[model samples]
Target: MHYNHYGREPVQLGVGLLNEPCASAAELGQRCAAAGLVLSRAPTTADLASVTEFLARWRAVVECVERTGRAALLNDLLAEYASAPRLTDHAGDGWHLHFRDPGVATDRQIAALVTVGTALHLTGLGMDRLGVCAADGCTRVYADTSRNGRQRFCSPACANRSAVRRHRAGRAAR
Candidate 1:
Protein backbone atom coordinates (compact mmCIF):
# COMPACT_ATOMS: atom_id res chain seq x y z
CA MET A 1 0.00 0.00 0.00
CA HIS A 2 2.86 2.37 0.80
CA TYR A 3 4.49 1.50 -2.52
CA ASN A 4 1.31 2.56 -4.32
CA HIS A 5 1.97 6.11 -3.17
CA TYR A 6 4.58 6.37 -5.92
CA GLY A 7 1.91 5.96 -8.62
CA ARG A 8 -1.54 6.45 -7.15
CA GLU A 9 -1.18 9.87 -5.54
CA PRO A 10 0.02 11.74 -8.59
CA VAL A 11 -2.56 10.22 -10.87
CA GLN A 12 -5.30 11.06 -8.37
CA LEU A 13 -4.13 14.66 -8.23
CA GLY A 14 -3.95 14.98 -12.00
CA VAL A 15 -7.31 13.36 -12.62
CA GLY A 16 -9.04 15.41 -9.94
CA LEU A 17 -7.84 18.69 -11.41
CA LEU A 18 -8.58 17.57 -14.92
CA ASN A 19 -12.17 16.65 -14.03
CA GLU A 20 -12.94 19.84 -12.18
CA PRO A 21 -10.59 22.81 -12.09
CA CYS A 22 -12.69 24.61 -9.50
CA ALA A 23 -12.63 21.79 -6.96
CA SER A 24 -12.77 22.76 -3.31
CA ALA A 25 -9.77 22.32 -1.05
CA ALA A 26 -11.82 19.96 1.09
CA GLU A 27 -12.39 17.80 -1.94
CA LEU A 28 -8.71 17.64 -2.69
CA GLY A 29 -7.83 17.10 0.94
CA GLN A 30 -10.20 14.19 1.16
CA ARG A 31 -8.75 12.73 -1.99
CA CYS A 32 -5.23 13.04 -0.66
CA ALA A 33 -6.22 11.56 2.67
CA ALA A 34 -7.74 8.61 0.89
CA ALA A 35 -4.35 8.14 -0.77
CA GLY A 36 -2.83 7.90 2.73
CA LEU A 37 -1.23 11.34 2.65
CA VAL A 38 -2.16 13.02 5.90
CA LEU A 39 -1.59 16.76 5.93
CA SER A 40 -0.28 18.84 8.81
CA ARG A 41 -2.33 21.82 7.67
CA ALA A 42 -5.21 22.71 5.40
CA PRO A 43 -4.23 23.45 1.80
CA THR A 44 -4.26 27.15 1.03
CA THR A 45 -5.71 28.85 -2.04
CA ALA A 46 -2.14 29.28 -3.15
CA ASP A 47 -1.85 25.54 -2.87
CA LEU A 48 -4.81 25.27 -5.21
CA ALA A 49 -3.08 27.54 -7.67
CA SER A 50 0.03 25.49 -7.29
CA VAL A 51 -1.90 22.37 -8.16
CA THR A 52 -3.22 24.19 -11.22
CA GLU A 53 0.28 25.04 -12.36
CA PHE A 54 1.43 21.54 -11.53
CA LEU A 55 -1.33 20.18 -13.71
CA ALA A 56 -0.04 22.17 -16.64
CA ARG A 57 3.43 20.72 -16.17
CA TRP A 58 1.91 17.30 -15.57
CA ARG A 59 -0.17 17.58 -18.74
CA ALA A 60 3.01 18.28 -20.65
CA VAL A 61 4.49 15.12 -19.21
CA VAL A 62 1.42 13.15 -20.27
CA GLU A 63 1.79 14.57 -23.76
CA CYS A 64 5.39 13.49 -23.70
CA VAL A 65 4.37 9.97 -22.82
CA GLU A 66 1.98 10.03 -25.76
CA ARG A 67 4.84 11.05 -28.00
CA THR A 68 7.25 8.50 -26.58
CA GLY A 69 9.30 11.27 -24.94
CA ARG A 70 8.53 10.21 -21.37
CA ALA A 71 12.16 9.70 -20.41
CA ALA A 72 13.14 13.22 -21.37
CA LEU A 73 10.07 14.70 -19.74
CA LEU A 74 10.57 12.69 -16.55
CA ASN A 75 14.20 13.78 -16.46
CA ASP A 76 13.16 17.41 -16.72
CA LEU A 77 10.64 17.08 -13.88
CA LEU A 78 13.18 15.27 -11.69
CA ALA A 79 15.68 18.01 -12.33
CA GLU A 80 13.12 20.65 -11.49
CA TYR A 81 11.38 19.16 -8.44
CA ALA A 82 12.39 15.70 -7.23
CA SER A 83 15.03 15.60 -4.52
CA ALA A 84 17.13 12.69 -3.36
CA PRO A 85 15.13 9.91 -1.72
CA ARG A 86 15.23 10.13 2.06
CA LEU A 87 13.45 8.02 4.70
CA THR A 88 11.57 9.60 7.58
CA ASP A 89 8.88 8.88 10.12
CA HIS A 90 7.58 12.44 10.01
CA ALA A 91 4.10 11.32 11.02
CA GLY A 92 5.45 8.55 13.28
CA ASP A 93 3.39 6.15 11.15
CA GLY A 94 6.57 4.16 10.81
CA TRP A 95 9.41 5.22 8.47
CA HIS A 96 8.78 5.91 4.83
CA LEU A 97 10.86 7.28 2.00
CA HIS A 98 10.15 10.80 0.87
CA PHE A 99 11.16 11.90 -2.60
CA ARG A 100 11.39 15.57 -1.61
CA ASP A 101 12.44 17.37 1.52
CA PRO A 102 10.22 18.16 4.50
CA GLY A 103 8.71 21.58 5.38
CA VAL A 104 8.12 22.34 1.70
CA ALA A 105 4.84 23.95 0.59
CA THR A 106 1.93 21.76 -0.43
CA ASP A 107 2.30 22.51 -4.12
CA ARG A 108 6.00 21.71 -4.30
CA GLN A 109 5.43 18.55 -2.33
CA ILE A 110 2.75 17.57 -4.84
CA ALA A 111 5.09 18.25 -7.74
CA ALA A 112 7.82 16.07 -6.30
CA LEU A 113 5.41 13.28 -5.43
CA VAL A 114 3.74 13.31 -8.82
CA THR A 115 6.97 13.34 -10.79
CA VAL A 116 8.50 10.44 -8.91
CA GLY A 117 5.21 8.54 -8.92
CA THR A 118 4.77 9.07 -12.61
CA ALA A 119 8.24 7.79 -13.35
CA LEU A 120 7.61 4.68 -11.32
CA HIS A 121 4.14 4.11 -12.80
CA LEU A 122 5.40 4.45 -16.34
CA THR A 123 8.35 2.19 -15.84
CA GLY A 124 6.41 -0.42 -13.94
CA LEU A 125 3.19 -0.45 -15.94
CA GLY A 126 4.64 0.47 -19.34
CA MET A 127 5.03 3.98 -20.71
CA ASP A 128 1.76 3.83 -22.61
CA ARG A 129 -0.27 3.44 -19.44
CA LEU A 130 -0.87 7.16 -18.99
CA GLY A 131 -2.84 9.28 -21.45
CA VAL A 132 -5.81 11.51 -22.29
CA CYS A 133 -9.31 10.12 -22.61
CA ALA A 134 -10.46 8.77 -25.96
CA ALA A 135 -14.00 10.08 -25.59
CA ASP A 136 -14.96 13.11 -27.63
CA GLY A 137 -15.60 16.40 -25.80
CA CYS A 138 -13.52 15.16 -22.89
CA THR A 139 -10.02 16.43 -22.18
CA ARG A 140 -9.44 14.42 -19.01
CA VAL A 141 -6.15 12.60 -18.55
CA TYR A 142 -5.63 9.34 -16.69
CA ALA A 143 -3.09 6.88 -15.39
CA ASP A 144 -3.81 3.34 -16.55
CA THR A 145 -3.57 1.43 -13.31
CA SER A 146 -5.97 -1.28 -14.37
CA ARG A 147 -4.91 -4.82 -13.78
CA ASN A 148 -5.40 -5.64 -17.46
CA GLY A 149 -3.86 -2.38 -18.67
CA ARG A 150 -6.71 -1.79 -21.16
CA GLN A 151 -8.17 1.44 -19.86
CA ARG A 152 -9.04 3.83 -22.70
CA PHE A 153 -11.35 6.46 -21.30
CA CYS A 154 -11.04 8.27 -18.00
CA SER A 155 -13.96 6.34 -16.49
CA PRO A 156 -16.62 3.81 -17.25
CA ALA A 157 -19.10 6.67 -17.67
CA CYS A 158 -17.02 8.22 -20.42
CA ALA A 159 -16.46 4.86 -22.05
CA ASN A 160 -20.18 4.14 -22.00
CA ARG A 161 -20.90 7.53 -23.50
CA SER A 162 -18.43 6.90 -26.29
CA ALA A 163 -19.85 3.47 -26.92
CA VAL A 164 -23.40 4.85 -27.11
CA ARG A 165 -22.28 7.52 -29.50
CA ARG A 166 -20.58 4.97 -31.68
CA HIS A 167 -23.63 2.75 -31.64
CA ARG A 168 -25.89 5.64 -32.58
CA ALA A 169 -23.55 6.65 -35.36
CA GLY A 170 -23.57 3.13 -36.71
CA ARG A 171 -27.35 3.06 -36.71
CA ALA A 172 -27.48 6.41 -38.48
CA ALA A 173 -24.95 5.21 -41.03
CA ARG A 174 -27.19 2.30 -42.02
Candidate 2:
Protein backbone atom coordinates (compact mmCIF):
# COMPACT_ATOMS: atom_id res chain seq x y z
CA MET A 1 0.00 0.00 0.00
CA HIS A 2 1.33 3.36 -1.05
CA TYR A 3 1.51 5.87 1.83
CA ASN A 4 1.30 9.63 1.54
CA HIS A 5 4.38 11.75 2.30
CA TYR A 6 2.80 13.30 5.37
CA GLY A 7 1.83 9.92 6.76
CA ARG A 8 5.21 8.25 6.29
CA GLU A 9 7.87 10.93 6.55
CA PRO A 10 7.15 12.40 9.95
CA VAL A 11 6.72 8.97 11.51
CA GLN A 12 10.09 7.99 10.13
CA LEU A 13 11.53 11.19 11.53
CA GLY A 14 9.98 10.39 14.89
CA VAL A 15 11.52 6.95 14.79
CA GLY A 16 14.90 8.37 13.96
CA LEU A 17 14.71 10.82 16.78
CA LEU A 18 13.62 8.19 19.25
CA ASN A 19 16.26 5.67 18.23
CA GLU A 20 19.22 8.04 18.06
CA PRO A 21 18.35 11.31 19.73
CA CYS A 22 20.07 14.59 19.07
CA ALA A 23 22.64 15.75 21.61
CA SER A 24 22.21 19.46 21.06
CA ALA A 25 19.99 22.07 19.53
CA ALA A 26 22.29 22.47 16.51
CA GLU A 27 22.18 18.75 15.92
CA LEU A 28 18.42 18.83 16.17
CA GLY A 29 18.26 21.60 13.60
CA GLN A 30 20.58 19.68 11.30
CA ARG A 31 18.59 16.51 11.73
CA CYS A 32 15.29 18.25 10.97
CA ALA A 33 16.80 19.85 7.88
CA ALA A 34 18.08 16.46 6.79
CA ALA A 35 14.57 15.12 7.30
CA GLY A 36 13.33 17.79 4.81
CA LEU A 37 11.53 20.04 7.28
CA VAL A 38 11.56 23.69 6.36
CA LEU A 39 12.77 25.57 9.42
CA SER A 40 11.76 29.17 10.01
CA ARG A 41 14.59 29.66 12.50
CA ALA A 42 17.36 27.84 14.34
CA PRO A 43 16.45 25.44 17.13
CA THR A 44 16.95 26.56 20.71
CA THR A 45 17.98 24.65 23.87
CA ALA A 46 14.37 24.92 24.99
CA ASP A 47 13.31 23.38 21.69
CA LEU A 48 15.66 20.48 22.28
CA ALA A 49 14.24 19.91 25.77
CA SER A 50 10.66 20.12 24.51
CA VAL A 51 11.29 17.76 21.59
CA THR A 52 12.93 15.28 23.95
CA GLU A 53 9.86 15.29 26.16
CA PHE A 54 7.56 14.92 23.19
CA LEU A 55 9.54 12.00 21.83
CA ALA A 56 9.35 10.26 25.21
CA ARG A 57 5.55 10.53 24.95
CA TRP A 58 5.69 9.36 21.35
CA ARG A 59 7.63 6.33 22.54
CA ALA A 60 4.64 5.45 24.67
CA VAL A 61 2.50 5.45 21.55
CA VAL A 62 4.95 3.11 19.87
CA GLU A 63 5.28 0.74 22.81
CA CYS A 64 1.62 0.51 23.68
CA VAL A 65 0.50 -3.11 23.18
CA GLU A 66 -3.22 -2.35 23.08
CA ARG A 67 -4.68 -0.41 20.17
CA THR A 68 -7.11 1.45 22.40
CA GLY A 69 -4.34 2.48 24.77
CA ARG A 70 -2.20 3.60 21.87
CA ALA A 71 -5.03 5.63 20.43
CA ALA A 72 -5.71 7.20 23.81
CA LEU A 73 -2.06 8.15 24.23
CA LEU A 74 -1.92 9.67 20.77
CA ASN A 75 -5.17 11.51 21.38
CA ASP A 76 -3.73 13.06 24.51
CA LEU A 77 -0.66 14.11 22.60
CA LEU A 78 -2.79 15.57 19.81
CA ALA A 79 -4.71 17.57 22.34
CA GLU A 80 -1.58 18.94 23.99
CA TYR A 81 0.72 19.39 21.01
CA ALA A 82 -1.45 19.96 17.98
CA SER A 83 -3.81 22.76 17.04
CA ALA A 84 -6.92 22.90 14.90
CA PRO A 85 -6.04 22.16 11.28
CA ARG A 86 -5.88 25.04 8.86
CA LEU A 87 -4.88 25.33 5.22
CA THR A 88 -1.77 27.29 4.42
CA ASP A 89 0.56 28.07 1.57
CA HIS A 90 3.13 29.34 4.06
CA ALA A 91 6.04 28.83 1.71
CA GLY A 92 3.91 29.71 -1.33
CA ASP A 93 4.53 26.24 -2.66
CA GLY A 94 0.86 25.29 -2.65
CA TRP A 95 -2.05 25.03 -0.30
CA HIS A 96 -1.53 22.39 2.40
CA LEU A 97 -2.70 21.66 5.88
CA HIS A 98 -1.10 23.03 9.05
CA PHE A 99 -2.00 21.39 12.34
CA ARG A 100 -0.48 24.12 14.49
CA ASP A 101 -0.76 27.86 14.21
CA PRO A 102 1.80 29.89 12.29
CA GLY A 103 4.99 31.28 13.89
CA VAL A 104 5.08 28.72 16.67
CA ALA A 105 8.37 27.58 18.19
CA THR A 106 10.40 24.94 16.39
CA ASP A 107 9.71 22.25 18.97
CA ARG A 108 5.98 22.94 18.90
CA GLN A 109 5.98 22.75 15.11
CA ILE A 110 7.80 19.42 15.21
CA ALA A 111 5.44 18.09 17.84
CA ALA A 112 2.45 19.07 15.72
CA LEU A 113 3.96 17.61 12.57
CA VAL A 114 4.88 14.26 14.11
CA THR A 115 1.65 14.00 16.11
CA VAL A 116 -0.60 14.73 13.13
CA GLY A 117 1.56 12.67 10.83
CA THR A 118 1.43 9.68 13.16
CA ALA A 119 -2.37 9.97 13.36
CA LEU A 120 -2.57 10.05 9.57
CA HIS A 121 -0.22 7.09 9.32
CA LEU A 122 -2.17 4.91 11.74
CA THR A 123 -5.56 5.78 10.25
CA GLY A 124 -4.38 5.56 6.63
CA LEU A 125 -2.39 2.39 7.03
CA GLY A 126 -3.13 0.25 10.10
CA MET A 127 -3.08 0.74 13.85
CA ASP A 128 -0.52 -2.07 14.15
CA ARG A 129 1.81 -0.54 11.59
CA LEU A 130 4.13 1.03 14.17
CA GLY A 131 6.20 -1.42 16.21
CA VAL A 132 9.35 -2.25 18.11
CA CYS A 133 11.97 -4.44 16.46
CA ALA A 134 11.50 -8.13 17.13
CA ALA A 135 15.16 -9.04 16.93
CA ASP A 136 16.73 -10.12 20.21
CA GLY A 137 18.77 -7.42 21.98
CA CYS A 138 17.43 -4.76 19.64
CA THR A 139 14.73 -2.42 20.91
CA ARG A 140 14.68 -0.05 17.96
CA VAL A 141 11.37 1.19 16.59
CA TYR A 142 10.08 0.97 13.01
CA ALA A 143 7.10 2.07 10.97
CA ASP A 144 5.80 -0.77 8.82
CA THR A 145 5.63 0.87 5.42
CA SER A 146 5.97 -2.47 3.64
CA ARG A 147 3.23 -3.64 1.29
CA ASN A 148 2.74 -6.84 3.29
CA GLY A 149 2.81 -4.99 6.63
CA ARG A 150 4.51 -7.96 8.30
CA GLN A 151 7.75 -6.20 9.10
CA ARG A 152 9.15 -7.18 12.48
CA PHE A 153 12.74 -6.04 12.41
CA CYS A 154 14.20 -2.55 12.20
CA SER A 155 16.64 -3.64 9.47
CA PRO A 156 17.51 -6.56 7.19
CA ALA A 157 20.60 -7.25 9.33
CA CYS A 158 18.50 -7.73 12.46
CA ALA A 159 16.12 -10.00 10.59
CA ASN A 160 18.95 -12.12 9.26
CA ARG A 161 20.55 -12.38 12.69
CA SER A 162 17.25 -13.45 14.19
CA ALA A 163 16.71 -16.07 11.50
CA VAL A 164 20.18 -17.45 12.00
CA ARG A 165 19.73 -17.58 15.73
CA ARG A 166 16.44 -19.42 15.35
CA HIS A 167 17.99 -21.84 12.89
CA ARG A 168 20.90 -22.60 15.22
CA ALA A 169 18.56 -23.04 18.15
CA GLY A 170 16.44 -25.50 16.16
CA ARG A 171 19.49 -27.48 15.07
CA ALA A 172 20.83 -27.66 18.64
CA ALA A 173 17.47 -28.82 19.91
CA ARG A 174 17.29 -31.51 17.27
Which ten-residue region of model 1 has the weakest summed lDDT?
Answer: 1-10
Give the per-residue lDDT of model 1 (tens digit) for 1-174. 454456677767666666667477777677667666666566777887887887787788786645457788778888888888888888766777888877877777777777888888888888888888999988888889899998989999999999999999999999
RMSD of each: 2.2, 2.3
TM-score between candidate 1 and the true structure: 0.86
Q: Write down the worst ten-residue block by lDDT for model 2.
A: 1-10
CA deviation > 4 Å runs, candidate 2: 1-5
Instruction: Encode model 2's per-residue lDDT on 49-94: one tens digit a residue.
Output: 9999999989999999699999999999999988888887777777
Candidate 1 Cα outliers beyond 4 Å, as residue runs: 1-4, 22-27, 65-67
